[model samples]
Target: MLTPSKPFTRRCFPAINVKKGVVMVGNATTFYDGDQKQRNVTDLVEGAKKANVVLEARQVAMKIFEDYTVSWYWIIIGLVIAMLISLIFVVLLRFLAGIMIWVMIVLLIAVMGYGIFHCYMEYARLKGTAGSDVKLTEIGFQSDVRVYLHLRQTWLAFMIILCIMEVVIILLLIFLRKRILIAIALIKEASRAVGQVMCSLVFPLFTFLLLCLCIAYWAITAVFLSTSNEAVYKVFNETVCDYAGKTCDPETFNVTNVTRLCPDATCQFAFYGGETYYHKYLIVFQVYNFFMFLWLANFAIALGQVTLAGAFASYYWAFKKPDDMPAFPIFSSLGRALRYHTGSLAFGSLILAIVQLIRVMLEYLDHKLKGADNTFARFLLCCLKCCFWCLEKFIKFLNRNAYIMIAIYGTNFCTSARNAFFLLMRNIIRVAVLDKVTDFLLFLGKLLVVGCVGILAFFFFTQRIRIIQDTAPTLNYYWVPILTVVIGSYLIAHGFFSVYGMCVDTLFLCFCEDLERNDGSLERPYYMSPELSHILWKKDAELLKSSESQS
Candidate 1:
């Protein structure tokens, strides 16, 4: 038998089998000339070229691996610093959220104000300089960005843009002052919740592990499924032959009548499209593998969300901070989510997975249709892709809130989704203004963490820090480690910040529910913190106070 075999993972070479007297292509080096069948001489050349390419790629991969190995400790150190910074940032939000938010707004205004000033100065300075008066529209586009920067019109345009941005930010701050206060309160409350349920910050690691497992399984299964097809052999002739396209068994191809009629004909391996029953269904198997991967990955994420939501909800619903909270809130919530709400999580994950899968299929179709000249079909595909993209985002948003509701109420997927949607709708103004504002603030927190860590990583890896110039590892590419640290830092920051985010969402929903279900009366005292209650429901609290005074 002339079947290809892999002797090792990275090293593959063709071998002649004297016992079978059959020539075979190795798996790694196989190259088809065109269509399916490979020509004898062309294939050898193509295979050698491909083999050289593979060898070069392997060498590059090895170099990267070596660089990573050498700098592994530095990477770990950078990542640990990132984690600590994230933790500190999250903890600080409890006390400094208001200060940070105000400072951010002020700084944004000042930065834009400075930008406007700088642009104006540049415009003034470049007023009479050579090429300074050139119109931007006259030049149109330039590969050299400096050319445009030399023009006064560019500075004028920049100044105008900065002015507009400055005005917009100032106007927004003026209009949304009260909402910002509410958002700050919510963020502080969320921080307090996260501080109490500290273990919630670590829960993302579990989810990350689960997702890794899902990804590994999917990749390995996909590889095996793709390679499961049996190779098909077809007749190839240097001269014209009627049976050239027909399939033949390589084992007995020599004794076949076509070979007898056409002496110059030979059998060669074509593509791996096999006709066996099992091979015929490989595409279905691959699709199933992809779907399951999506399901499991989403399930892992949903589990984390529900668990964090449950822990934070417990904190929110507790009247007296840790006194009314559970002994191990995170563990307790995890157990509850696993024991009672796995089905709900799975159900939500299933819906999300289906939507995601459909989006993937649409993307695949779009890619397949790129070469086609049908404008209508392409337009329809573009519309479908856009619609599905929006649909996926909506489902994700709905599912996130639904998981929060499920964590609080222990309800099924549909009931929780409905309740969460209606609750958000009822508080649509708050959701739009306060909640989104809080999210923006949290995003800024993440950006700050990532930026700080990324800058540190860049300096260290590039040997720009004189203090650690001798300590940093030498590398083939400094950007690799820098990028790794940046990306890792972001994930670390996102994980820690996600706890705050989930806490905010849980507390927000709890706050909304508390308003609807309770008054200031002793019988139905609100579970929300006094600060949050006073800030968000100031009018309601005032009315209640007057009513109480009248009584």
Candidate 2:
């Protein structure tokens, strides 16, 4: 009884003590009794900020280090330094050259003055030698001597003037060196850029030009084949009949008329193969007759053949070697080929047109020459028929292998002819002797272009000597130096441009590769920050995990 009363009243050490330090079983607004939790939360946020700052600093340093490591950047810096050094060198050279040029000019003037004085003295001596027979003879000799002296003096004066001028020019070279170098550099850079651009555009341009020509050819064929252009047909018919030199009836030439003309042994022998051979012979005869009637046609065919061959040869040469491949040269060859082909085609067409006109005129003449028979008139009436046949054959040939014709036209007829010969030899030699003949032809073509270019350069240098003389009288005596400098300058410029063009071409190719790798999407970030990169990786990982878990 005493224990139950005491337990209720006394709370003695309490069976259970509820304190603020202890956490509650149920949800409560405040669980901890101290500020430790709040302090820990603040410390965590501050620590995170400090860690982020440290990471950012490290990332920045790493980026800086990486940027410095890139080869292109260092290369660019090195190139800049090199360019600066070259500029300084050029400037110094120019200064020295200028001084020399002035000195040479002064020397030239002095030499000229001396020559004039000597010539005057010679004249005075001649004047003093007149009178006695001895004196007279002496005077005559003196007169001749004076004339020679004068000529010598004049020549010497000119020579001295030229020498001095050359010296001056040599001195001025210091100044010109910079300009020359700069021009060369610009040319090189431009050439490289141009080469790359040209390479990119070449295929499309070639295709376009080919299409244009093909369309034109087709249109012409269509027009000629049309029933409307019967006039062209009439001219062809009349020319053939004139070539035959007889008013022979079509009945004799016609398929049905063979029975009447085959009475003789010669006719029987000619007709031995029957109608098929007769038809073939007639076709051949008509073609020959048309070609013969128009000499220009032969020229066109020959030119076309030659041009096609040349183009093919040039293409083969251009693609033969990896190191030899240069955009400018390829483009230049293409341009030259196009130009030559166009000119040849235009000239050929003009000539052919003229021939056709002449043929028409001749037809009129023959019409008048003949007794104006209705049979002749009938042949003339079928003029469109002959033109249609010719046009159809040509179109067929073109359609079957327009590529060959286009290639020839693009490369120029000359190149085309060379390629044709090479191909022919390749085939013939392969069949008869060896297959390596093609390699020989390829080598030959390459050698031809290279050798031709070299020879042309030499020829130009030689011819420049004359040009220099014409342009600068003072340069006559210093021909060697002047010519050397000019040629050297040109070569340097050419080489620089060529190298620059090649570099540009290579760079463009690299860019193209990059594009291809990017799959034409070009929109993804190219540059990334370390922090962003890390975040992206983390996000990616999280997404992957979530996806895997779902699966």
Candidate 3:
């Protein structure tokens, strides 16, 4: 019995339940049931690490794309393309000047002919429309009488005398070409020198004044914004609504009734039984309108000054002649100057006009929405108040930071004056020392290309890009890549041109400095050494001595 008990397997343990409903037939320790699903330890850890890596990669890619999109390379490439286009246009314009003069003559003749015909038709129409009792004068008779009367007037007589004097001066100029050319050259040289000095001194002062103006504008804006009286705010809000549409409760107005009164549509007086918060808002609006009007007027005046100054500068440069000036070169220079000045003024005027129109529209909205008995009168009064307010504020603002602007203006003026002086001196030396053809062509090429490119690039980047619609939800995701490429190309081109310009400036500066130091007087060379001495300083004294006699 004892042996039998020992041999017995001690009744097999009950089958253990394992995960996935499997039975464990052997060891009881091998099988167990748990609430959580089983998974490999290695797989769980690896999956978590992989997810983190993916998230990090996405963040890195986004940052990299943003960085590349805004790089300077794109800006430079855009500028170069603009310059090339501008140069071509300028050259074409210069070539067409002669043709333009002829075209103008033809246009003038046509205009005169049209004027005569218009007068005749008006006279005939008047006679036909007149009553039987009223006697109508003949067109030719009326025209003749008007002309005779004009001729008899004092101003007209003076104008005729002036015309005769101008004709006489022209005849003198043609007969005394050599003397005229010499006088012009001398005058141009003097003007260039004076301009250089003024630019160095006066230009800086002007820049300082401009900076003062900007500061004054900001200070005034801040003060206006701070005023407790809600008139300006009301006006601005109304204007914004009128132009942009009253789509939602404007955060600017802070009017709660917008939602309560007009639950479905925009909060207008018609929707609120004319008892809405709009009236209270209008009072604030009027005040704002007044200041905006003043700001616009000042902007217009500034624009006018810029335009007139540019025109005067262009005229001065255009009319001035050199002793050995080539006709084509002078013509080209004149054309380029005219085009640049005209384009600058046109662009500036357009921008200002748009701003003015916006201001006017805001003022108009304020007046209209308020239901003032006399809208026009209210508008005029608001305008006057705004002007007064702006003037006082501007003066105060300028007083606060006058010194800073003055310093900036002084520095700018000095730089300009130095440049002008250098240019004048260089030109004088060039005329006396260097061959005209080489210098003229070189100068023309630089001016035409650089000036044209800068202007064109400004236009294209600022304007053209705005028109392209990239059909993407986010700008950075799609357009950024395209922009990066364009900008990179532009930058490369710009860098090349900039390097060339730097070289030229360095050479010119070195030559001028050497001439000044040596007191070479009129015998100095117009250009500095061709070598890139600035890049690597080597024997300054030897370089100076070499350049001294050459100048």
Writing each residue's lDDT as its tens digit, candidate 3 over 267-322 gives 32212223345556754665565444445444433333332232222322332322
Q: TM-score of every model?
A: 0.72, 0.18, 0.22
Can you rank all candidates by lDDT, best first?
1, 3, 2
The C-alpha stretches of model 1 lying farther than 4 A from their native spots are 1-70, 100-175, 231-273, 474-476, 539-551
List candidate 3 segments past 4 Å from native: 1-76, 95-216, 227-551
Task: Name the top TM-score candidate.
Answer: 1
Write the candidate numbers in order of decreasing TM-score. 1, 3, 2
Candidate 3 C-alpha RMSD relative to the actual structure: 30.9
TM-score of 3: 0.22
Q: Which is superior by lDDT, 2 or 3?
A: 3
Candidate 2 shows a clash count of 27
Superior by lDDT: candidate 1 or candidate 3: 1
Residues 161-245, candidate 1: write the lDDT tens digits: 9788678767777876766777888888887887787788788999999999999999999998887888888998967688988
Candidate 1: clashing pairs of residues: none
Whole-model lDDT for model 3 versus the true structure?
0.38
Give one digit per residue, the lDDT tens place, for model 2 in 455-514: 333333334446543432221112233233334333333322232222322222222223
lDDT value, candidate 1, whole model: 0.82
* Model 2 residue 13 CA deviation in Å: 99
